[model samples]
Target: MLTINVAFLLAVIVLVRLRRRTEARSRSDERFTVVIVLALGVLIAPTPVGEGIFDLLGQLASGITGASR
Candidate 1:
């Protein structure tokens, strides 16, 4: 029996799609990529890795705001 993780599959797809030349992608292709990436985000958002990313981004945002003030 083979078990595949969907999030892992989507991440691979996103990477492959992004590696293509920008000029090679039509508008619809680009939109499809965006949808895939968004789906990947939703899949990742509840995991510990996602929470860590959120914390890191929050720290960076606060640091920028603090510097500006």
Candidate 2:
């Protein structure tokens, strides 16, 4: 039996979609890409990788604020 992870598949799709030339994308194409990205975020948010990303972003935000002050 072979099972593919949906999040990984979506990530691949997002990569492929983004690789196209920016000038070639229409408004609807951009909207579709946004929807795909949001879906990917939702699928990944409960996993350990998502928690790590959250921590990393938090630290980055704090560092930026500290540097500004």
Candidate 3:
């Protein structure tokens, strides 16, 4: 569990640094970044419009884990 947590933390840090570098080169009117963040936020969080997405992901994950046996 400790190793898994450390790995997850490292992964998050690396991803954040990479994303920051990527965003640093973009202009203020970055519609692509805005849209991508909005879509990702909506997908990961619960809202009326996001409920279906969350449900689908949950079902998919469940199916994948269930099939691993």
The numbered model that scores best in TM-score is: 2
Instruction: Say which prediction, candidate 1 or candidate 3, comes out ahead on TM-score.
Output: 1
Local distance difference test, candidate 1: 0.95
Cα lDDT tens digits for candidate 3, 1-69: 334443345445545644665546556535655655555564446656568777888999999999998
Best-fitting candidate, scored by lDDT:
2
* Candidate 3 Cα errors over 4 Å, as ranges: 1-44
User: Which stretches in model 2 have alpha-carbon errors above 4 Å?
Assistant: none
Residue 20 CA error for candidate 2 (Å)?
0.1
Per-residue lDDT of 1-69 in model 1, one digit per residue for the tens?
999989999999999999999999999999999999999999999999989999999999999999999
Candidate 1 positional error at 3, Å: 1.5
- Using lDDT as the measure, what is the rank order of every candidate, best first? 2, 1, 3
User: Candidate 2's residue-wise lDDT over 1-69, tens digit each?
Assistant: 999999999999999999999999999999999999999999999999998999999999999999999
Q: Report clash pairs, candidate 1.
A: none
